[model samples]
Target: MGSAWTQSFREELSVGKVKFSLSQPELLLQPQWSISPLAWLLYRLFMLLYTFIWCLYSALLFSSPKWLLFLSHIVYCSMAMYYLLALCNLVWAAIQVRNFYRNAAANQNEGSRVRGGSVGPFPLPPLLSAALRLQWCLHNLVSSFSVTVTLLYWMLVYPIEKHPLSTFNINMHVGNSVQALLDLVLSSTPIHLAHYVHLFLAACLYILFLLLYWLSGGTSLSRKPYIYKVLDFGRWPLVAAFSVIGFICIGLPLGHFLLLVPLKV
Candidate 1:
């Protein structure tokens, strides 16, 4: 008992009271979120929060310096508003799909051994399977191409020299009717218009994912295995994420939102 007590205290792993405090944060570790749809939803939520906080932090950082803060807000507000609008719209769609599935499962599972397997196998004919796969492949390819081009513009082109607004493929067609109106009203600059347009295209892919998710009615058999399904949902987001990583690799010449105009000396 004496040696046990000595060894426990001597080891770095044991500190008794401090262990509880140290491990408190780990209690929030989310195993349920290991699955894809859940994970993607969490990720989307976090990114939305992250952008919001990042903008807020930037705003507060320059609070004492009014001119600089206003300048900072100009960039932050322009970018953040679009992000917030898109994020909320996507979240609402996801919730609609989720609730539709939940109510659906409740209806069809009166006394079955299974939960929601009544969705049964898809009636996809051989032709349709091939066609769906082809469509998926094309969707992924175009999505990848868009990611690549945008990253190239942000990293290589913008870093060295400013390009004309005509360079980027900026078409602003996002959201439902009401949200689209907000996007149209808010988006004025060519650069911001370009960003918002790409987001709109990305939103379409997400909507397609949501459509597939609910079309199959969000059941286990109605879905792919959880891992595959999550990967499927994350496909386009992954492209965008990695492309952003490439942009981060280039990073900024100095700090965040530093130079919009080319310096002349």
Candidate 2:
């Protein structure tokens, strides 16, 4: 045991001790949102509405057996899948927003209110939240690809092709491009070139699907065994060359531009 020695001190003395604690600001760790809550909510509603309208239009066209024949085209197939993805993303975003609002309300004990400018609540574990954000990024990237493909087809392919205009008219070509562009603009994810890999993969899968469909004896309305005359497998060399050029030059660049344009704002 040590002896307690009394010493004379001139400094201020207090009966109780003072404690100091340090805390990290939540903003430092929270994910940065690219858009406001109100904007995102309105965009979600618009996507849901646009998806419903497209589905109804497709259903009406499918009612006719003649119109059903046009479904073999890659344009219709890709646009259909794009809208479906948009609907899915919309649902996920809605759920996230709801949870954000609820959490903000419950956490009001800390004097933080759920407002349009807030970071919004994210209750998901770190890994799960990251995965969700990645999915959202890929989803928007695909939306950009859909728009690029649709416009390229319309301006370049459809104009030169001799396919029946009646069949094409029933497929809602303009609407598909417009809705996809809207989705791309309304997306809150920051655009990154690395995400372009998802677009490439999607294109590759679509090309494979077209090849399989052709192998199964699918024929377009023009009586051509190929959906796009340029993609006719009979000329494998031309098809390969065009695919390479399209992916590298047209598809990648177009998608990159489409995604970056809105971000420039």
Candidate 3:
């Protein structure tokens, strides 16, 4: 019966694909919060605004050569991107809260008194409350720290060069008498190091995120399901994706100018 029920629920979720959890905490809050559609829509609206701003920043840099070298402009754009990500997460958090409210309403309608108006049934499981609080703290701290550091790094490292791509000495093996290829990484770079740090922190955030989702659902971490195990392993692909993009975002523009550029492969 649970299999049939889970299957039906999964099918409905798949049809929309836009809403609900593929894994943990997202589903946790929905059943618990009873979030209203209006509340959810409001959060989505924030995301829309957030995306528009990102596009605006990109266009500004691509079109206006004047802003490219200005440290202040670069800082502003970086900060804007950070804020956008933060806004998205804030919306996610709201969705979770709403789900809590929805679930509370459901539980109350059944006369269970489970969570009066989203407080989560009295005497609320003390451990559950503690766990949820911990999860929230971890997620927010990671989010804020990552965004803050990223903005600071870009601001401090804005390039002075007009067209930075001219400097890298390129080597190619078209006629291969020798098969060896030279892979060079620049030795002195704060920007490259800062991005590495960001990658590490982001990984921490993803793991913390999964833990939080489990806590929100009142599920014990000890009993992590096969699905979550799959999510945990997903970190590798995420890291790979981020690595390429990070190099492009941080290293590519600078690498073009730097005397000694690193080979990402």
TM-score winner between 2 and 3, please give it.
2
lDDT of 1 at 209: 52
Q: What are the TM-scores, per candidate, against the unseen true structure?
A: 0.27, 0.58, 0.25
Local distance difference test values of all predictions, in order = 0.36, 0.53, 0.36
- The candidate scoring highest on TM-score is 2
lDDT tens digits by residue: candidate 3, 56-164: 7555545744332322233334334533443454456566566777777777889885654556432323444444434333322323333333332333222321224
Task: Give the backbone clash total of model 2.
Answer: 0
Counted clashes in each candidate structure: 0, 0, 16
List the candidate 1 regions with Cα displacement exceeding 4 Å. Answer: 1-35, 61-75, 109-265
* Shift of residue 51 alpha carbon in model 3, Å: 10
Q: Which portions of model 2 miss their true places by more than 4 Å?
A: 1-43, 62-121, 125-131, 134-138, 162-172, 221-223, 235-240, 262-265
Indicate which candidate wins on lDDT.
Answer: 2
lDDT for model 3: 0.36
Model 2, 61-156: lDDT tens digits are 556433443322334444455445544544565576678777676677466654454653345545444544444544555456656666665665
Expressed as tens digits, the lDDT of each residue in 1-265 for candidate 1 is 7787555434423333212221222111222223465564565466456546755665574454332212123333444454554445445545654676676677676764446465443233354334333322222223233333343445554554453454111321111112222322232211111122333354455445544654564433223422122223444557544444443333321211111111110
TM for candidate 3 is: 0.25
